[model samples]
Target: LFKPVGLGYASMVIVFFCNTYYIMVLAWGFYYLIKSFSSTLPWSDCDNEWNTPSCIEIFRHQDCKNASFANVTVGDRNMTLLNISSGLDEPGHMNWELMLCLMAVWVLVYFCVWKGVKSTGKIVYFTATFPYVVLIILLVRGVTLPGAYDGIMYYIKPDWSKLEEVWIDAGTQIFFSYAIGLGALTALGSYNRFNNDCYKDAFVLALINSGTSFFAGFVVFSILGFMAAEQGVDISQVAESGPGLAFIAYPKAVSLMPVAPLWAALFFFMLLLLGLDSQFVGVEGFVTGILDLFPSRYYHRYKREIAVAICCLLCFIIDLSMVTQGGMYVFQLFDYYSASGMTLLWQAFWECIVVAWVYGADRFMDDVARMIGYRPFPWMKWCWSFITPCVCLGIFLFHLVNYKPLTYNNVYVYPWWGEVIGWCLALSSMLCIPVSLLYKLFRGAAPVHHAPTPDLQTPRRGPADPRAPPPTTEAAHFVRG
Candidate 1:
């Protein structure tokens, strides 16, 4: 397929928006990780300053009005600590604790990747493996808990209606998990030797990624079941998804375990590592994309460090809004729009067209055969050529048709202007594709005569190859090497 520089640029833009808000989750993790050092888990009881009269103790889980785990009870409504603020309009002042944690996270990321791959490689040894160890420990403990079986059963049982409703969410999860259209994998993959068996690596990565998710489900639901049983509630009542699950339900469940603080520490530490690992790749992708734009000019003179620092600082500043009392509302806005499933699907559709239709799926297979010594499964060709694009386009249209305004905690609907701003965020990245094309078309591009050589001994030049494309653009330079 003819490589479109804008598509690459668009992917980088998506990564930037994703990394900006994504790292804020790590700050929350840090806040909880630090709090886990306490004699008792802060959210385990309704005794803390943040707790309200509606707060219910974890062990005495009685259904209050609109009750949620380990938080306030309003009339008959139960609320968690997460919903303390009435809505987006009430975003109070900055939370100093979370702000400090956000800074700490950025600093950690800057230090880890400032030296580029050297520092990143060393840290991955721990960041990648430690999560599995914690997961295993948690899974073992979760299974042996009083109501673990109930949780496991809840997880295994399928709710067809719920699945139908959330199919788009499931698609987005797959894209996010696989790093599709993010360019992080593309940037990282560029580091490999030309002859590396990426075909094999792709399958390995998918298997491991999906396997980890399935295994982690057991760890989560088992504890959730135990919480439900302890509280004399249904698993559905105690089990929450996303942030509510991580910050509220799971923390409350762990508090009931023996040595609650230790369990809390381990769980949050795992989250910290997971967030850090993702942050590393995302930052690296963004940095690598930016630096490569100017090739030979910025490889020295501490340029990489400066780039990393500036990126971290900018994201940290923008993230300040998320640490406010009303920050969760802001977080929801970003999460719902920035790098969302719709944006990803739009990108994926174009990618499939460029590769499978415009570029020729047969040619791609041939290229893969050249690198891996054999073509991949024939089914792959069908997937790229027809199945993938059609499916993405179909689901994307369905999502658009059924779209609703943003809401928080299933209440507090966002204002019309808020929805406008969210669409702007989504289009900011999605528009990069067409914008880049127009830029290239108006600026005029030299057709690539051949693929770029991989030799990196020279700054902008590679070993002579008749098949190599001229180094006219950043993408061309990348292809050259």
Candidate 2:
């Protein structure tokens, strides 16, 4: 079996690669948030230098006289600003606005997590709650707009035939939402006290996350309905997906609203908070994995602060390529390969195998019982041992078999060399497993042999016992999985 150190190292690799580009998204959010304060949003019309003659303004308000609201001429300017370069081959110079935003984002992330949970924990009080406030406000405003009912209905209406094509996408969304195989969840979990009722916490977190997602759908679709109505197009035509939806369609939708800048500012502020919340957590997870490798190394004053600074600086330098004129292509490549569903499922499958089959699921249940003071239902044991790993492996293989080249708005497929680079990004993280295994094997590490099944017969150990593990926040003995 791979040691905890090896697993932790692998987790760090995943987080580092994922976070590097992931935070670039936050930089975009910062740019939009700053831009939203203007009387005329940059994307609200075709007047900007970045816009082409073909650019069409979709804002339907009487105040917007650039073109008839519904007359979309011959052009769609959804991502024109972000995708100024023709393609990945023509990576133009750095976008100083976005570059500065990226630097600011990295700086903010560093300060938030430099002190670890002490500072981040406090910040979550605002970051975690503020999005919901904005979403609520948006939902209320959205439902009042003309054609809002159409949008909400379109959002809630089931499309059965699409399931065959999109079920895998849905699964991937679930993984991303919960941060399933990411070390951030595990790193955050490590801080819990031994008897802190994590089982309950897990259920609550799942509910909240899923519920928020469902609720946000209303906020989004309602606005999309308004956009479609303004453009005299079906909701599907105006319901742009991905960054186009967030950066273009949604901004234009808000610009037509009363107090346009106010609503736009709130929307982008919520986006910034959401991205920062995720960003700092991912950074913290990587930092924790590194610090744990040599706990003694952090004994010096401000060592953690220095470590976080270095991490942000290195990642910022590496990510500078993504803030260039062709940065969107690079960003999409990283998002597709580095944090793809395939990589996530691969990690999750192995994690389940190690915990359930290798270490024994019944024994794990016993450990949980020891921590939470009762045995969970037996079905959860079956899930850990059989159900989850099989599902992960099945989906992993399915994705591999059906893999497609990355594209931009389904128009520009990445070149063969670009695809090769994407696969390399993917393999960089997945290779950690075999690399760790080979290292252990070369060192002549013995395969672990499990003892008899745990029947809750052993008494808990105390801090005074030399054999006991370190104490938890609640003073209970540490229980290693």
Candidate 3:
């Protein structure tokens, strides 16, 4: 009864953390895209408090605090607003090392996509996946840092405000971060044998994603501590502000270091590469959904090479804005609307309606037993039917009760138009699910999910009823004896 419920709960949590980590990865990608064309380092003493006093005198009147506007000094002159407040104009204010890391990441991503879907499949052995490696690296490096404990302590030392904040953040993070309902998971699942144990695989993937985030605190936080020590400030002050932690905190670290540019590029590059994995998956999800829905579009045109090429062309066209200065904005727009809250809520809702109510629990389980060769526990059964729907419904209700747009910096809100467009695009992506369900329902076409059960040819014995006069002759003989 509760087996599916547990799956729901676990999938939700895993999805949430998955989104958050991916955002960090996105930031890293942004760093490298910038680094590729730049001649000098993006950050410099030329842009900060190190700038001379006269330069600072020019923009002293501006709202530097809210603006993150700052003064810098270089060669006997103070330059204010030359750089601005703490980090780059970009949120998360990343560094070189992170940027370099992002480059390596994207290069791998591009290469993986270059050949087509099959190539991507081949790369999965190492490239199309491998975040766990970076995550483990973070765990080790984080705990070893001088002020590692502070980040961990602070992370959970919640203010009630953060609960409200994190709740929303967590929801959105899960929606955008996870590629489940968007068709990535399903499409990926398609690659497995018809009877592949998807429920199990989903659970494993979700665990890996969430568990890493929990552990990532040590890696991410320790670095924050390292930053704090250099700035001679409390850990809280230098701590990651939000999902933008890497971008903002990392740059400051590079700034403090004597030989920063090299490290800065590397760090930011790594961050960029990390994003490619998630980003490509996101792209792939839509591609798969399209191919699945409109068979004629590929019309058996879905050859891996041809399909991959077309998808690449489409991605290039859509992603062109990412190459521009406003690319970050595009990423943010996608991030806000395509959040886990929205995706999972819808996934949970429809998955329930289709599997539980539409197809029937017995049928669903039969499918599972057929594919996986064993029945899910009662709990698992219940979740696909009930728990997942409840949680998803709850999240959707929460959003309707309280929703807001993604803000620029901490305070600047996106316009209503941007919000509307974002939601529209987001809604369009999830539409396939309902369309599929309706088609299956109306056409009576919910394809049989499980393998056909082989009929038993021989008569099976029921346990003898002890209450019955079992084998009267034998009993009588025994009594007589």
- Highest TM-score model number: 2
lDDT of 2 by residue, 1-481 (tens): 2343255556677789878999877888788888877888777777777776667655454444334334342125332456357789988888898999998889888888887775677777788888999999999999999989999999999899897558888887788788887888777767656556778777887898899889999999998898766666677766766776777678777777778888888888898998888887799888877777776844878777877888899999989989888888898899899888988898888888888877678877887887778888889988898899899998888888988889976678899999999999888878888787677668876543333224323455312433344334321211111
Q: List runs of model 3 lying over 4 Å from the truth.
A: 1-41, 47-111, 114-118, 128-145, 241-243, 257-266, 294-303, 430-481
Residue 116 alpha-carbon offset, candidate 2, angstroms: 1.3
In candidate 1, stretches whose alpha carbon ends up further than 4 angstroms from where it belongs are: 1-5, 60-84, 439-481
Alpha carbon deviation, residue 323, candidate 3 (Å):
3.7
Order of models, best lDDT first: 1, 2, 3
Candidate 1 structure quality by residue, lDDT tens digits, 1-481? 2135367777877899888999987998999999889897777776767766766664544543343432332111223344347777787778888899999999999999897765687778788889999999999988998889999999988898888677888887898888898888787766654545788888878898899999999999998887777766677777666677788778777887889999889999999999998898899889988888876944678999999999999989999988888887788898888888898898899888877865568877887776656889999999999999999999889889989898865657998888999999999878877876666568775432233223311233312542454323332222222
Which 10 consecutive residues of model 2 have the lowest summed lDDT?
Answer: 472-481
Better candidate number, 1 or 2, judged by TM-score: 2
TM-score of each: 0.88, 0.90, 0.67
Query: CA lDDT of each candidate?
Result: 0.77, 0.76, 0.50
lDDT of 1 at 240: 66
Error of 3 at 389 (Å): 0.6
Clashes of each: 17, 0, 69
